[model samples]
Target: MVPNVRSSLPVTGTKPRTSWPRKALLILGFLFALAAIALVAMAVSQNKPLPKNIKYGIVLDAGSSHTNLYVYEWPAEKENDTGVVHQVEVCKVEGLGISGYSQDTEKAGLSLQHCMKRAQEVVPEQQHRETPVYLGATAGMRLLSLQNRSMADRVLSAVEKTLRSSPFNFQGARVISGQEEGAYGWITINYLLGNFKQAFSAFYFVMNFLNLTTEKSPVPLDKATSAVESFCSRPWHEVKAEFPKIKEKYLSEYCFSGTYILSLLENGYGFTMEKWQNIQFLGKIGSSDAGWTLGYMLNLTNMIPAEKPPTRPLSHASYVGLMVFCSLVLVAVLLLSWLTFHKPKCLQKGLI
Candidate 1:
């Protein structure tokens, strides 16, 4: 006899099964509760302070005792155990500033070029070469006679020849003021301490002009980017006019974030919340801190910043236009010089 078969089926026309939807709702509720708890934990953990990227490398022939080159970088993952944020040391340059030099590097370009070649060898990343490199002389440069420190051509020429055309890809160096220096110092402290999220949170949500409730932030930022965008539009001074209570602390946050974004745009490097998904308050380009220092010196001490004027700036965008115009001008000048030196025959030769 064949094995008997058994089947159990619902009664005809009975109500259809409906347990799947109920189970899904239950799981979702549980997940929502877990997420809420996690958010609270994250907020509370942020209270404790942390550290900063002390990424120093040599910029000049910095002698051992006085050669203290301060390096800053976004901590690397391998350095996490040490609580470091900087992974790469992007830039370094010799001398404090251009105003400290006197030589025209046109004839001596080779020697300057050799020094830069050695410097660039340390870190060969193409991107690092373009990071904003800056220089600012100390009291030493100030002591030089006007003739001794005439750096307009020497500095510019040296950069072009020595550092392989701005080895750190600096648009230019600017002398900043004391206020700026203080601002950077404040940022450096906070960055080292990891006090940004809370500091920012308090400023945007808790301490608005109206003192809005905690249920929502006072500012209309749905996310960090939007908040930053609003801040960028107004000068930090203007923003501080509204809040006299925590003016110093708030101003520090404003400057750090503002300078980072400005550096990102100016250097063709984009900084984003995405880059900062797991990180906090630091940047890739060198000299925000240095800029902060120069800023303080200039703003507070009432000093002047100097520069090397561009020897040849191609106004047109395309290389073809630049080459054609520059070449024609050079040839004409050479011909004129020859004619000036040797009259009739030289003039005829130039015309040909």
Candidate 2:
């Protein structure tokens, strides 16, 4: 009976226990991945500071084709003149741009007034026009017909009359070249990047040498930029273009400088572009090159539409995917082992 038991032992099939170290290692690897992702998520979240109100802003985007009023406001304490800007809303009117400025000055002024009227509803009463409104006139304003010009003057005069009579003051209007406008947009974004809000912050004080300020600053030429109609997702620009400020040159320049897509990149994400006959990496921006400069600029404009958030946190999906893959691998291993371990017995027993 003892000999028969020993012989039967050779025929017995059993799975050996897996190494404890292997199981521990596998579990530890999964935990490590989760921790890494969470750490990254936390870092990204922390990097985005809450919106600050360095100060309020209002813009009159005047093109030869049309005109529109853009209003933005923020908390007084959190933001500075150049800090993170929180946009309230953009209020506009039909036929506001240069058509109002050029073709019909009276209508142009009405459009301007209408834009301001709508903006007044959105901006809070307390933060309301505490400071004077900077009425900046651009190309369309620069090119009005005599009748249109007189109409524009009357419209602005009426606007000034309203401001003087109201709780706020009209700080007089000024015409700026497109270059100055481009510089301002750059400045706004950079201030947010540098974390100093006021136009007169310590950073600017320290960096003013780099700003293009000179005893005789060159003025930008009156050039028309091409339009990138594909970029403007909303019809607001149509309202904007109604005034004729829309120009080919301005559009092209605006497209290159103010790409909403830049807002979407995170610190860890990267892309490659072929430039100067070389494939260049994007993530680790270095020494203020175009890619890195754009990256830093994008860091400030995080609220751009192109920077829309992900549908969900990466953890749940990534972890579940990893688990599925690991489980599939584990099942494959068990199947292979069962087939291998029993192959000899199956053959010997004529069970194959």
Candidate 3:
């Protein structure tokens, strides 16, 4: 009678025990959630894009008129890619071109000190040893070699000595061929204009010879002839007044330069009037001068690869996202399986 009364009365002192399976399910869910969180953290940390590793290069364009020091830089990862390399700085060496220092061969090297120092300042001190510095003498040095091979050698030696003394890795100092100059100029213009990867037609004419007097007149290409003729006919005082900022020496050569360029384009290169319209009189393309310097550096450094680099089918983010999605689906499947296998006995009995 006492036991029957106790069974009928409410259990006051004791609480119902939690099922082991239910506790296990809760712990598994917490663990799976923590695992998912960890997977997400790992994906984010491991797949993030790395910082850019920039590489520097130096090229000295020792032209007939003047010497130009060009500092170029590109990402180390994209060295083989096109349109990535660009000019960062251009320092003009004062006085004259290296060939002009033939009288005092030692001064040819000394003249480069200012620009080389500027390059040192532009590039990091640490990179100096790794940065390759190249000096390519163009028409001036070529002419010097033709006139006097021994003098050209001495001039080159002097400049080489100076470059070797610097912190940079001196590649070489020598006179490049006209064929090389023309080819490199073409490469520079097209490269800077992004023409390598697309369909385009263009021509680049270097007016290096225009500083001297030319017997040929401007060819009739569009308004080029008229413009040059009109400018040349103007009074010297008027010309000076119009271009006050231009140095007298350079201003005086404009007429000759215009005429020589037109003649070269039409006669030397054999371009018709129609083709002349397509010619791009570009001094620069996006801060980079349209010249042989960049092309020269690119060739020596092997920055431009002949073949395209391999690429991944999926982007980094897409790959990571897909992994996370698959992980979540797996977690959901496991949760459903646990629920199906560990259903309450009452519910299972009701189904039966």
Candidate 4:
């Protein structure tokens, strides 16, 4: 017997099948993709380099051991925040600190001339008249003040005369207490760490206002090794009861400096030894030194205002990320719509 064959014809009575919903979806997807592209273009156009108007300040750190002159610069518009001012150059005066010239107090002022001349060279001439210069004599001067008030005053007067004679604006020259030194140093480190934005509580204010913490934090040890091993492994009371002994052989002066720092952190600031271990001591953070000089400059420039400035708009990185994420979502939607609307065509090609 021959194989039977049958022919099938389209049913003309029924309307041709149409998927309006699928077509609509595809049109919406395309429109969404176009909108995403437009948004990306708009964001790209708006992304421009921030205007960089640079400003400068000068500070002479007249310390007990020695004197150092520092030049700092920041964006003119951002002077009201922390970690913005950076030390561009530092000139260390030759010979002893200003206190060494107690007998010949006039020489104390002359000692700073070398560094001031260098400052003139470092900063622009136009900014010289407007740039304020400050002199903060540290522990050495403080001791002199206690020993002989008149001599200390004479030393400050001499330095003030020298600074006034210079082309720059002389703000003032005076001895800063050890407590202020420590507190300012703390501010410098915390600012560099960018911790101010994350935590600003009563403790922060108390530490800032009352404590004399320095910025020269020790390099960050592995937290697990330091805080966890030392504190977590032992009871808090036990750790607090006994202080760790220092065995490393460093400069003899470090003994005094270390004790002074510990006293400042504990007695001066009311921080526990365990809390001290948590603190990081760094010589330099990024490109700037972790010293009180930066804090001093910031104070003069009003970089750290009492009231926080208006919150800034979204950052550049966030803006870029948002654009990219939107673009990806739009592409995915477009692909899904294409697949859905063309199912029949895929089926005809034996692809579905």
User: Best lDDT goes to which candidate?
Assistant: 3
Cα deviation at 276, candidate 3, in Å, is 3.8
| Candidate closer to the true structure by lDDT (higher is better), 2 or 3 | 3
- TM-score between model 3 and native: 0.67
Clashes of 4: 11
Displacement of residue 89 (Cα, Å) in model 1 is 4.8
Q: Considering every candidate listed, which one attains the maximal TM-score?
A: 3
RMSD of each predicted structure: 35.8, 19.7, 6.7, 15.7
lDDT minimum window of 10 residues, candidate 1: 61-70
Compute each candidate's TM-score over C-alphas: 0.27, 0.37, 0.67, 0.53
Task: Estimate, for each residue in 69-187, the C-alpha lDDT of model 1 and write its tens digit.
Answer: 23233222223233233323323333333332434435333333444454456544554653334433332333333345455435444544544464465333323333443464454
* Residue 302 lDDT (model 4): 69
lDDT by residue for model 3 (115-226), tens: 9999999998988998889889997899999999999999999999999999998989889998888777777867777676422212223232222222243323656666
Candidate 2 runs further than 4 Å off: 1-55, 78-83, 129-131, 145-167, 189-273, 276-352
> By TM-score, how accurate is candidate 2?
0.37
